[model samples]
Target: MTENQILQVLDKYAKDYNFPVLDNYNFDLAQCRLSVFRDDNEWIIVFEIVGVNPSLYISNDIYAYGNSVESQGLIIGLDDIVSLPNEEDLFDDEGNFLITPFHLDLIINSEPLIIKPTEGEYLELGIQTELFNPTKLIRYLSSKYKEKFWLEPLDLLNEINMSEDFKLFYQTDEWEHTDEEKPSENKFFQSLAKAIVLNDKNLIQFKKANTHWSNWTWSDFEKQEED
Candidate 1:
């Protein structure tokens, strides 16, 4: 249906069923919002509710199925049929989730490094390990490499984006019924995976030099002064 027609349906629902209509929203890129819109074929109206958290959000959709113009009266005969999720089902009880795509895309060494949470599933419930935290990765690299690491940032990016295991980990994090055992959480695996990919001769050299210097005591400085 057209936007005007959608608005009219919303207005009718508000008047007849006392349904609240929230059309305009200014998202902060750190919060989630519910969406109600017609399907691509205009045969169904879909209502999507997003459960938000600090790192991400979880979403579930309900449909008012049938053609709007059909005798089915899907849009006209609107009812407040709602199914609420249990408190445990919510991704973020504090409600600090982000639904929009992050604006942290980078072009490092001519390769694109994007931070996209795989759909809405991998973003929450510990499926996303620390390696998936793009900001943290950036901060760590910037401080450790003096901004020189961006020349080869794709190593870390690929580690995050190219892993089939990472995707499967999320896809199977929650299962309704299964004979196999659930996957155990691997908190350090993400960091280890990234380190395996990003470690190079330069980083090794830097680490060695830093470690050597870090071992110097005040007596070592005094010895140097005497020498």
Candidate 2:
């Protein structure tokens, strides 16, 4: 079928299903392609945009361009898709590789939501580490990471970035505390910075120390006498 014909079908579904229009949703029919299907009750639309967001939207026609290519019955049975090139196969022209640092996951009321943070987020994190002020850092981070009743975990980080209050807080300096009082503050901040950059376990250790969420402490590491 022609692109126009496929679009007409999608338009019908958009009206019937009330699929939301994505922000700045525009695509070129010649360059990009899509696949559409319904899994259970939800509509899934997958995009194949080169060097851009490869997304699967739920009940959204924003990327639903056409009917997916029909699968032919396999001539030879294969247990895995290892024949196809994966994202790991991609590399730069200069041969230096790019890697995804971390993916955020959350279980909200028993449903799992996962998302990868944008490159801009990593840049912002680097700036935050550079401008680190130990005394106000916790309060600053708390204001950003505070619980939101309405937000899905995927939306929370974006919401934090959008907040005008956070922008002001990020820009201002209010460090009045002495280094003597919190001697370990710099080291703690360093660990936190390293954790953010490397997406390591150091962040958890730092949070446990600072927040006192559990009763765990240095004393917990005390070696018990061998029986």
Candidate 3:
């Protein structure tokens, strides 16, 4: 939809429904008055509609020790909302909205990387023990070796034989260990996932990095193994 159309829909919703307050929401209606922000490099629509209250401020103009100011505000990120066309009557399905090829085309055109699982390699072993999915493992090693490449995780998993106990141990301890070690690459991917899911613009850096990694050479892939 056009930006104007999107704004109109939001305005209509504000008038029709009482805006519900979300807990721990960090949007600033004033700052987002009519603009979008990049949260991890992804583009996100943010704005102050009506209803919700903005955070409070305390100010004392010379005389009093402290005075408070109250204002009602709303901050909404694109991730927090969904858009749909308006339908007049349910029984009369004349202008009912339908998914269009354009939507699918857009997704296909964007072509985000797909995380794959290795064959024969247990899921527990790859993500748990290796702390990397197929794409992630390749990306990790590529950077270490200063090369560019892509591969399916399922294919890699199929090549390795992992014992049951080893798989179990990795599954139980990987997340806990990751929290303590805070691997930069894993953290970066996790943040990127959140940005994509939320449509947060802030994650653009990681997205670019991912795009660059998609074109690595075979020699680069070999270097990653050494790392």
For each candidate, the alpha-carbon lDDT, in order, equals 0.25, 0.26, 0.24
Q: Candidate 3, residues 1-227: lDDT per residue as tens digits?
A: 23233333334333543222112132111111112223222222222221112221110000000011011122222221111234212112554323221121111112323333343333322222232222333223233322111112232122122111211101000111121122233444244334434555365332232223222222232234577
Clashes of each: 2, 0, 26
Q: Which stretches of candidate 2 lie over 4 Å from their true place?
A: 17-20, 23-45, 48-227
RMSD of every candidate to native, in Å, equals: 25.6, 24.4, 24.4
Top lDDT hit: 2
User: lDDT at 206 for candidate 2?
Assistant: 29
Checking candidate 2 for backbone clashes, the offending pairs are none
Residue-level lDDT tens digits of model 2 in 62-149 = 2222243222111111111111123232225664323223443433223443556554554553323332221112222223342211
Candidate 3 CA-lDDT value: 0.24
The whole-model C-alpha lDDT of candidate 2 against the native structure comes to 0.26
> Per-residue lDDT of 91-137 in model 1, one digit per residue for the tens?
24665322233333444333444555343333432223332332222
Better of 2 and 3 by lDDT: 2
| Candidate order by decreasing lDDT | 2, 1, 3
